[model samples]
Target: MRSFVYARPETIDGAVSEMTAEPGAAYLAGGTTQVDLMKDEVLRPVRLVDITRLPLREVWSDGDALVVGALVSMEELAGHPVVTERLPLLREALLMGATPQLRHMATMGGNLLQRTRCRYFRDPSVPCNKREPGAGCGAIDGFHRTHAVLGTSAHCIATHPSDAAVALLALGAEVRVRGGEGERVVPLTDFYRLPGSTPHVETVLEHGELITHLEIPLLPRGARSGYLKVRDRASYEFALASVAAALVVEDGTIRRAHLALGGLGTVPWRVPRAEELLRDAAPGEESFAAAADAALAGAVARPDNGFKIELGRRAVVRMLSTLAKES
Candidate 1:
């Protein structure tokens, strides 16, 4: 591993100032993903600013919105009564993601900030535009079975790898950030960026910004929600395709819907069209199929990941059906 300077900040302002003072410094939380990447030479920060010591861990209900601190671990969020009861989709997504041990250690902020799982980015030998701009994307003509089908550009096809993020997007949560500015809230849907010219920049977060917490606005009570993941394995694997849906079906008609897809795009893919289709449709196979079709209508697929378009649709359909039954 590369030798790097390390510092732990007790205050958020100190951490932000330290990071802003250094161009190539990263905030370290669990170090579960960042450490491995450093060893592989995928990432080599000049300084590691430890932020786990900062007091950002908390989970509470603020009126109708459920607030979860960035330092809160997946295990803590998943097991929280407020999370499980009010946002079952989030708990379901967390349960389907990483192993129990990792989940216990992984922070929510770290998970949202995790980098893409693209092979080209991880391997120094490969030519990836994301890792080295102007080098060209290796996945373009190589193995891309796990690549993106939406929001992809010539520069990159790498997809985001967080199931929890998808659920967060579907729930219409907002992320609270602190940086050079005092504090600001960014809608979760707007936090992630599409793989445009700069695939390296996965999020809209500024250089020294620290994610403080996330707030999930309340929807209809007892909302029917579910998260479905399709992967190469049943457990301990990255998603091939996944859908997280929160639906309110009442009197045999859809009242409202929130839809977000994973493993198919550069970010947590929100399908406004799918939500529109489910808005007033009856909970049935035709309705679900229509919503799925609307969600993937204009997806541009690569050679190896064309099947993802169908897989994503089916996953959405299955999740909607399951949630509908529960409703």
Candidate 2:
């Protein structure tokens, strides 16, 4: 690993300042993902600004929404009373993301900002557009079974590997960021950038911008929500296809539904067409299958990963069916 200067900032402004002062500086919270990248030489920062000391670890309910500080650990969030009672989908996603040890150390902001788990991107020896722009993506035609099918580009096919992020996207979470220019609130849907041409640019966050907190709008009183993950293993593995779903069933008819997919797209994939199809429809196999089809309508898959298209549809149907039955 490359040696770098380290600074522990007590304030958000101090952290941002420290990051901006050095062009090759990165903010460190849990260091779960950052440390791994640094060890792999995939990310070589000249300076590391430790923001764990910053006062961004609170998790509270604000009016009808939940406001979670960026530094809150995944394990803590998963077990928090407010989260369990109000946002069960988020809790389930958090718990299923990693092992207990990793969940204890992974922070909310860090999870959302974590890079893709593509082998080509993580290994310095391989060419990856996300790791080094214009070098070419080695996974495009080589061992891309775990890569993305939706929101993919000719330059990159890496899947965004955050289960929590998929739940947050379905919940309509908003991110609060503080940077050199000051503070701003960005919708989670708009936070991620598609890997069209500039695959290296992943998010809307500018250099030295620090995510402070996340605001998730609470579900309706009668709404039921859950998360389902399918992977190679039962535990401590990334999802091959996952679904985060919330449904409000009133008098045997679905009134509102929100669905987001993970492990199948370049970003946390939200399917509005599927959600729309579920609205006012009865919770049955026909409706569920139709919604699933709508969700995977524009998916483009490669040879190895084409199964994900069907798997993603089944996940959507299964999650919605379960939530509908519970509601």
Candidate 3:
């Protein structure tokens, strides 16, 4: 790895000041993904400002919402009683992600900022528009079985690789970020950006800003929620397609539903069309099928990932069907 200046800031202001002063400086949380990327030379920071001791590690309930500290590790979240009880979908997503050892070292903020596992984007030899602006995307004609099928531009088709993000979007989670200006709240759905001309810019986070914590709004009691991921392997692999669903069926009719898809978009693709279709519709094969169809109405598929369109639909149907049966 290339040598870089390092600073351990005890306060948020000190960390922000150091990060702002140093161009190409990155905040170090758990250092799981950052260190690996640096080793691979995919990321080279001029300075590394350590924020692990900046008093951001904490989790608590704010009356109706679950507030998760940014520095909280995936392992801590998965094992937390409140998280497992209140946000089972998030817990399941994290459990199915990286192994125990890595999860213990992966913080929530780092997980959200983690880049795609696209071969072309990771390897310097391969041409990738995301890695190098207008360099052209090799994944378009190369191995792209795991690429995105929705919200993809001709410039790039790489998919976001966070299962936790999918569940967070479904649960109406909000992110709290601190910058040189101050703190601000951004919805989880709006956090990630669609790959337009600039696929390299993946999120709405401004430079020198730091994610502080996550806030998950209170969902109705007795609501069923879950995450389903389909991959080439059963475990320790990224998703070929995935769905995060939360539904509330009342007297055989769907009263409320939240549906979001991952592994198929540049961002966590929330399906308002599906949500609208499921509203007041009976929880049955026909209704679930209709909702699934509505969800993919705007999907634009690539040559290799067209299968994801159907895979994503099947995932949504299966997840909703299972929720219906249990409810």
- List the lowest-lDDT window of 10 residues for candidate 3: 296-305
Candidate whose TM-score is highest: 2
Sequence-dependent TM-score of model 2: 0.99
Better of 1 and 2 by TM-score: 2
lDDT (C-alpha, whole model) for all candidates: 0.90, 0.93, 0.88
Ranking by lDDT: 2, 1, 3
TM-score of each: 0.98, 0.99, 0.97
TM-score of 3: 0.97
For candidate 3, write residues 1-327 as lDDT tens digits: 899999999899899899999878999988877788888888889999999897778999999898999999999988988777777788989999899999999999889889888888888887888888889999888898889888888889898998898888988899999999999999987898988999989889887899999998766778888889899999789998888898888887889999888888877789888899999988989999999998877888767778989998899899999888883
Candidate number that wins on lDDT, 1 or 2: 2
Cα-based lDDT at residue 223, candidate 2: 84
Per-residue lDDT of model 2, residues 169-263, tens digit only: 99999999999999999999999999999999999999999999999999988789999999999968999999999998989998999999999
- lDDT for 232 (candidate 2): 96
lDDT of 1 by residue, 1-327 (tens): 899999999999999999999999999999889999999998999999999899899888899998888999999999998877778889999999899999999999999999889999999999998888888999999999999898989899898999999999998899999999789999988898877898877889999999999998766787888888999999789999999898888898899999999999888899998899899889989999999998888889877789999998899899999988983
Ranking by TM-score: 2, 1, 3
Cα RMSD to native, each candidate?
A: 1.0, 0.8, 1.1
